[model samples]
Target: MTTNPYDDIAEWYDDRVRSAWGHPGDESDLLAMLTGLTGDVDGLDICDLGCGQGIVSRRFARMGARVVGVDISSRLLAIAAREESANPLGVEYVNDDAQSLSRLSGGSFDGVVCTWSMADIEDLDSCYRSVERILRPGGWFVFLITHPCFQGPGSRWVGAERVVVDYFAEGFWRSENPDGVRGKVGAHHRTLSTYLNGLVEAGLSLERLVEPCGIAPINASLPDTSKVPVFLAVRSRKT
Candidate 1:
């Protein structure tokens, strides 16, 4: 059976997302970098691709950007929508696949932000293509993903050293979430080259790349994670 990570663990995911004092608006550094690349967000339309529970979506709206959140999981979207109802942030939540983005208008978005969800997606090429189609010319597509070279389910800690066995293989494996509530969740793994080449094929020009030191909540617990790049953030512009 195919695995659904956030379906049942939506509550857990929501709590963790809210409690993450470390990551304000996913990551302060990421927001700064995205803004630097895309310019001011005020009065701009943005898509939160693969947005789970609309955590970052609301943040962007608070920053004066019109935010539209798209995700495949009904459970996650429900949570996001519920929160939107309570806060009236004007953030719209759509139940849609990131790989297609058919429901979103083409060339309508000023920027796309996919935070910590790139590895969670399987068909990244299609997602990039759809994002490119939805973005206006010169619009930026910014993403944060677990470093394909350093982080994965197969990682092992041997005396302070985090070692990974296979760097070339791309596949899905059960998630190792600390709460253990989402054991059936699968994390899709891909190489750095695959993502880079896929963006190039999608006709997006690579503008900025960031490897934040264990800044995200998921990697903050790992020993010495902050010392090395555990999460990689990339910004590409549609030409």
Candidate 2:
């Protein structure tokens, strides 16, 4: 079996996500934006694509959605399963690749959400296709990703502003900053057009898009990001 890149850092990543819950910024903003775009998911069958440790999955379950959390990392899924066993929210965690959720039945989901995990997926096109396949007609697909234009490789904060060294360099790349998440797991960078085009090609219709602004705990070396939009959230429907 191929080694999952997130397996080794599962604990570290879980801790980071847990810590973010206490901070009233990026994490909170992300969840708010997600739920807002999804509207009410009561009794809806929802899939949490690339669900790391049941963070968003639990939230969906709490909101009355039957949730399935899928990811490639067994270590992360273990933690998520452990949490489910402990709390028993009826969330099912599946160890599977986001690009090809072979175990999930087609047209089985009323909604699908991918949060902060799109960059981790290697093939955006395949992932979007999988999402469209799993979603029932008129089902919604919502996602949050670091702004492709401002958060790609070689981009960083200079004083109060963000600097992008290159926007057209699209591919897999690792951040030089050892302390950041990208430096550890790396990320596949895609242009905004590539992302939108992939969704359109997958038979998904764009509905709403938002560039959200929030303050999150950052490395001391970085400046305030509240004034700048760091993440982009999109809501689409399967046509």
lDDT of 2 by residue, 178-209 (tens): 86689998999989999998999999999999
State which candidate has the highest TM-score. 2
Which segments of model 1 are wrong by more than 4 Å? 1-3, 21-39, 175-184, 214-219
Each candidate: RMSD: 3.0, 2.4
What is the per-residue lDDT of model 1 for residues 2-37, given as tens digits with 9 covering 90 to 100? 225678788887777776633434555555554555
Candidate 2 lDDT for residue 6: 85
Taking the candidates one at a time, how many backbone clashes does each contain?
0, 0
Clashing pairs in 2: none
